[model samples]
Target chain A: MPIIVNLDVMMAKRKISSNELADIVGITAANLSVLKTGKAKAIRFSTLDKICEALDCQPGDILEWQNPAEKT
Target chain B: MWNKHRSLKLSRILVLCFSVMIFMMTFFVPFVADWYEDVSDGMGLIGGSVYVPMMVTLYVCEGLAVWAVAELHILLKNISKGEVFIERNTRCLRCISWACLLAGGVFGVMALWRFLLFLPAFFAVMFGLIMRVLKNVFEQAVEIKSENDFTI
Candidate 1:
C-alpha cells in the first residue's frame, strides 16, 4: 500500500454517496467500500473506467502513491 | 453414478470404519498376536520370545494409525464443506504425514526382527511422502487463493 485510493475524497468532491456511486459504477456497495477504504489489492481497468465515468474524474484523481518511509 | 460428493462421503465412511476397526483391534491384540504366531508356525520372530517387543511395536503403530485416521477424518470433513485449500486442511495433512512417517519408523525398527515387516514400512514411508507433497501443494494453493480473494 504505498499506492493509496483517494476514492472517498473524490466522491466527497463530486457530492456522491457510496451507494449512489456503486449504483452508477455497476458494483456492489461492499466493493465500493473496499475501493474507498484502500483495501483492494488491485482495480480492474473496466471498473476504473466505470468509476471515472460515474464520478466525472480521472483515475489519477482517485489514486495516489506516497513513499512509506516519508510518511513516518 | 460416481461423483465428487458421493466419493467424499464414501471416503469419510471408510475412514470411520477404519477407526472402528482399529478400536476393536486394540482389545484383540494379544489374541491376534497368538493367532499370528500359530499361523506362522511359531516363527521365532513373532512367538513367545519376541512377543513383548512385538506388542510394543504394534501398539505404537496403532497409536500413529489412530492419529493419522483422525486427521484424515477432519481433512475429509473440510473438503466436504468446500474448504479444501484452507490452512486447517494443510495442518491435517502435515499431521497425517508425520503420523505415517512415525509409524513407518516404528515398523522399520520391528523389521530388524522380521524381514517381512519391511514391506509395510516401505509403503508407509511412501504414503507419508505423498501426503507431504500434497500438504505443500495445499499450502501454495491457500496462498494463491488468499491473494486472489484480496485482489478485488
Candidate 2:
C-alpha cells in the first residue's frame, strides 16, 4: 500500500501528455492510464523498461516507498 | 433452408415437451394405481425409490438443457457477430458446452442401458443427439473465434 506510482507527477514535470508517453512506450492509452493512476495490479518488466526509457527517469523516480501506509 | 440450428432448437423444445407428456401419461394412465409408487414401474425406475424422483429429475435436466441451449445459441451468435474476440472466453465456453453434452450423453446412455426392456431407444438417441449438437456448437464457436483472433 505504501508503494506509489509517481507517473502523473513525473509526467507533469516533464510536460508530457499521457497520449505522447503511450505512443513512445508502445501501449494503449487506456493501459497507460491504468499504470499512471496506479490502478494496475502489477507491471511487466518489459513495460517498465519501456516507460523508464521513454521518461528518462530512474525506476525509483517513478516508484516511491512511503511509511505510515495502511495495508491494502 | 429451414436450417439445422432451428431444428436443434425445435428438438430441444420437443425433448422438454415429450418429458412433460410422458409424466402426464404416466400420471393419467389407469393401469398405474399409485401416483408416486406405480409411475416408476411405467417409467422403468425399478424397485428402488426412483419413480417420482426420476420424473422430477427429467424435468430438472430438461430445464437445464433448455437453458444450456439458450446460452449456446448466444455463444454461437457471439461467434458469428465477431463479439467474441477474446480466445480465453471463447475457449472456456466451448469447453463448458462440450462438458454439458458429454455428461448428458453419458447419463442418457446409462438410462437406456439400465431400462433397456421397459424404455424405448429414443432417450438414448436423444442423448446421442445432445452430444452431437454440442460438438457442433463447440466447433463452430472455435472456428469463428480463430478467424476473428487472426483478424484482430
Candidate 3:
C-alpha cells in the first residue's frame, strides 16, 4: 500500500459529491467508497479513464506514492 | 439425473445406508461369531476363543467408521447448501482422515493376532491417505478463495 489514493482530496478540490461523481463515472457509490478508502487492490485502466474524465483531472492528481517511513 | 446435486444426494444416501448397516451389524456380533464358528470350523481359520477378540476389533473399527460417516454427513450437507471450499469442510475432511487412519491402525494391529484382517487394514489406510490428500487440496482451495474475496 505504498501507493495512496488522493480521491477525497481531488473530489474536494473539484467540489463534487461522492454520489454525483459515482454517477458521472458510471460506477456504484459503494465501489467509489472502496476506491476512496483505499480498500481496492486494483483499479482497471477503463475505470481510471472514466474517473479521470468525470473529475476533469489526471491520474497523477488522484494517486500518490509516499514512503511509509516518511511523515507527510 | 446426472447433475452434481443429484450425484451428491446419491452419495449421501449411500453413506447413510452404509452407516446404518454398520450400526445394525455391531449389534449382531454374537450371531456373526456363531456363523463364523460354523463356517470356519472346516477351514480351521480361527478358534472359538478368537471370536471375542475379533468382535472387539470389529466394534472399535466400526465406531471409528461411524464417526467418520457422521463427518461425511456434515460435509455433504454443507456441499448441498453451496458452501464448498470452506474451513468447516476442511475440518470435516481432517476428522474423517484421522478416523480412517485410527480404524486402519486398529485393524492392522488386529492382523498381527489374526492374519485374515490384513486386507481391510490395507484398504482403510489407503483410503485414509487419499482423504488426507483431499483435505490438503481443500485447504489450499480455501486459501485461494479467501484471497480472491478480499482482493476487491
Per-model CA lDDT versus the true structure: 0.85, 0.60, 0.84
Q: What's each prediction's clash count?
A: 0, 0, 0
Q: After superposition, how far is residue B44 of candidate 1 from its true place, in Å?
A: 11
| Ranking according to DockQ, highest score first | 1, 3, 2
The runs of at least 3 residues in candidate 2 whose Cα sits more than 4 Å from the true structure, single-residue gaps closed, are A1-3, A65-72, B1-55, B79-152
Docking class of 1: medium
Q: Which residue runs does candidate 3 get wrong by more than 4 Å?
A: A1-72, B33-48
lDDT, candidate 1, B63-139, per-residue tens = 99899999999999999989988999999999999998988899888776666778889999999999999999999
Error of 2 at B48 (Å): 9.9
Quick one: ranking by lDDT, best first? Answer: 1, 3, 2
Candidate 2 clashing pairs, residues 3+ apart or interchain: none
| Model number with the top DockQ | 1
lDDT of 3 by residue, B83-148 (tens): 998999999999999998898888777666556677788898999999999999999999888766
| Shift in Å, residue B20, candidate 3 | 1.8
Better of 1 and 3 by TM-score: 1
TM-scores of all models? 0.84, 0.46, 0.72
Error of 2 at A68 (Å): 9.5
